[model samples]
Target: MKLRNWLTLVFAAALLAGCGSPGPPVDPAPVGDVQRPTPAGTDMSGQVDNSGPAAPECNPRASLRPDDTIRPGSTMDDIVKRGYLIAGVDQSTNLWGFRDPHTGELQGFDIDVATEIAKDLFDTDDPPIRFRAINSGQREEVLKNGEVDIVVRTYSITCERMQEVAFSTVYFEAAQRVLVREKSGIQGIADLGGKRVCAAENSTSVDNLTEADPQPAPVQAANWTDCHVLLQQGQVDAVSTDNTILAGMAAEDPSTRVVGPPLSEELYGVGIPQQNEDMVRFVNASLEGVRQDVWRARYAHWGLGEVLGNMSPPRPVYR
Candidate 1:
């Protein structure tokens, strides 16, 4: 099957099969055979660093002017003229961006955000929108190369990333946490000092996990579902990333649970090309509208309210 078509079937089958009932305990060990990199300590803190060199780092917020611009001759106009919004997103993060296995349809919270963006851009929720499934590593490339109009994946806004592209105001907030089997005896991230851990390639979790004081031997995968497979197969001791992603993993594997507290604050933003400041403002305006009610309905529709609690959406700020 093609990559996109295979994604939903592969993940849904794996998770559903693995989560049916309790499984045997796992004995995690140091993963020495996997290709890995050195730790960067606390330097790659995954937060926006304003103290860096004097360059135009991306502002965490979009223009807060009550009257924002999304007029003709802008990027928004270009997209409108094109008659469709090409979005880069994930297809296997479950509640965040997974495809529904049963229905073979794309659906998730991030997917909903894309739908909303399309709805506002073309004045109809049925607006032509296409989804391209990209992994953590492809988030920046897709936008930089003009492969997509915007990226709504669980992309964190960082100073380093800001140097490469632009971001709208935060639409959602997440925290990095740990996911381990129920009987893994792992209580938190601190306990994974010498154990092998899995994180998505080119992701903040990789640097964060590697930077642990004692440090975990890192295993890289293309998606959280890959990490989920490794943990299920007892190939890795733990997996770490945003709690939202981990929550999906935990839901898939009944024997696994999200352990440990938050590792870092992650703000999810709509990634636009550096030249599309107008598009950024338009997306920010759309986000403001969604914050009023769309997010609540989305959260409920995905049944994510229980795992994430009552989220009121992130407040908007200007650069």
Candidate 2:
């Protein structure tokens, strides 16, 4: 079989394997999960939106019900019963969650989010988290089959995805954007006429860029890093992806930079299996903690201020 065909087959088999067994149902209860306030107040009114549509206000409290069977304090019990907090993530998306060459350990923004949840459950700030490297298409399936307890792979919360998985409140916000060589003179998506643009296969970035006005040829790469390699080699004029991922790429390559404004805005939510309300609530609370206590610190440590601007301390937006 061809290489692309082989990869497709492997991904299909992984999804099939992930659908065999449903994990234990979440407990229903209104236990007091800790709620930490965001350091900076949320003001979406002033937030810019260059992407497809503004995010609808989702009710975080709706995911938490007072009559829920599982009480708040049961988060640890659930994980202990399950043995490990199996987190599905992308090991190739740098700055979010990638395997470090020196340590052979997964590290990034998403990894930190998972670590926070593990800490909340184990009462240790640095609890060990087992990661299952997953592709964009495999995230929901991994959660469905109990292959992973949570997915923190820069997943965007969409109505369609909600049908298959429960998502926590918006922990991090990102936008679809373009990245180009500093000397390419490509200002934004509008400048891509007749230019070759690359995006990850099976990603929303491909769909969005392909449907743009000028309709530049959309090349598919196995991952964003692969797409960046193509761009560096002059195989493509520009590469497009989430702003966070693109920023990380730019950090690695001084010759590259993110161009123009964002094309679309998206919210990053932690993925839990659908109907796992207890787990959803618990994870939501954990996200609130990250947004308040650790988000800004990590962003600065990761040098994200250049791309994200003064939004280092994320403001909470609960509806």
Candidate 3:
């Protein structure tokens, strides 16, 4: 009888405890897709029309004085002291920054650029290069938070982005184009009207698609590789982005080919956090040194000729 009374009291105590009220239901994390921020007053309408944002000249703010470059004892002193260069780069953007599937080693045009910068900073490109693999959405946050010293992953220089980070003088120019399955019958951006088009979220490529004449249904992915998957699965009709990127995707899948005229001009620059103007100048000087035959050899080495196609190197325009 005492044991029964004790059990009844324990049950009553359990009932009084806070396990009775279930909290609000929790949602599962989003897979493959994320909510990307858009500018205030971003047109939600997927309508394509002639009336769209005017295309800028794609010129960045003037670069720092090339003659009087950033000194080693300045901002770069800390990076050297750290013993390794911390670079934020894309690990999936084909010729620009993808890792080799067989060797599992990072290799790309941007990787080469980062190597050159490391060589200049540390006196040897073979030094420890700690790569932080990040996607388009993470670029600004990573730079702003000091998560990386520099970003060299096919990053474009933009007036808006300048507010967050400083960029080296333009080193490469890429033009936006469309990629479609060879048999899809889609010729270009104009042909994408009413079809599903995939572009990386927070990329200017989406904006280009939205401004097309007969709008496509936009599908946003976390990475360009995700868009490639969607295209192969027939979930998206076409993938549109810089031709430099499209070329890399095309190389991966023989069934897909880059089609269409240029949609936008992408000026590639090395991204440095705003706090490190010295690093910016240091990077710019490295670019100037590699601007000639050196960059050409890299483009040829990566088979970027299909996209770059005799493109001249961009000169410095200092602010």
Candidate 4:
């Protein structure tokens, strides 16, 4: 049978089987054999002598302004009044914010960004940044309700999303991609026509796959981990998501690999509720700090060198 016909039959059968039950969660294969790098410890206490006079402290809260106010208008006031910066993030995405088995603390690229922002606010460079776990669908709501001062999840900047929240300058550029078994013989998105594919629910992956020319039937899982499980079980032919995410999945399971170049460009940004100009400015400055320092170091430490490359030393793009 043609691949298309087979996919259609499977999708029809899936619909008959009911389409709303949540799929089982998929965990990445253990990092047992992979020689993962060790995380860089918090050691900024006395290491400054080697780097010369460090850059002027960007923390503005320490000094009082000419008008006798705390640096004119600042988000510091809001944060101080609230007592803590509530950050919304995903704890399930490995290399982004998955919980560490030993400490039970969330760790990833996004988590590092959040910690930097908090450090600037507290002027400690190691302040305690509080994180609130949020799913993809709840990011907007959490920001709108003031449940979180900022969202550092892998949120893409899109026209529709801009209406609900303001976005910082692009911090990381990623692309939609496909992952398949090493011997699956699938080359790219074009070959997914007759194959079953999976992606996280409420993610751009599903939308992009749904709009493909061949229109593959997408299995929406609660998370990419779940989607990976479906692929391993031979229930799906491909898993679609950001190339960075697929890379993480492949790192966990050498039997699977990401195939083909990126399908579409995606720029990640920090999200804040719309009209909060103060919050937006604070976040932009904090992101600038991240781009300048610690960004590359974190990627290297986290084993993301293969995907991010030299993009780590971020060039400033102020708007």
Measured by lDDT, the strongest candidate is: 1
List TM-score per model, in order: 0.80, 0.75, 0.80, 0.74
TM-score of model 1 (CA atoms): 0.80
All candidates' lDDT scores?
0.82, 0.76, 0.81, 0.74
TM-score for candidate 4, residues paired by index: 0.74
Which pairs of residues collide in model 2? 27-70, 28-68, 28-69, 28-70, 29-68, 29-69, 29-70, 31-72, 51-263, 51-264
Model 4 per-residue lDDT tens digits across residues 190-209: 89885678876667777787
Q: For model 2, state the Cα shift of residue 121 in Å.
A: 1.6
Could you tell me which 10 consecutive residues in candidate 4 have the lowest summed lDDT?
A: 59-68
Query: Which is the winner by TM-score between candidate 1 and candidate 2?
Result: 1
Q: What is the C-alpha local distance difference test score of candidate 1? A: 0.82
Clashes of each: 0, 10, 5, 0
True-vs-predicted CA distance for residue 208, candidate 1, Å: 0.9
Using TM-score as the measure, the top candidate is 1
Q: By TM-score, is 1 or 4 better?
A: 1
Q: Give the Å shift of residue 21 in candidate 2.
A: 76
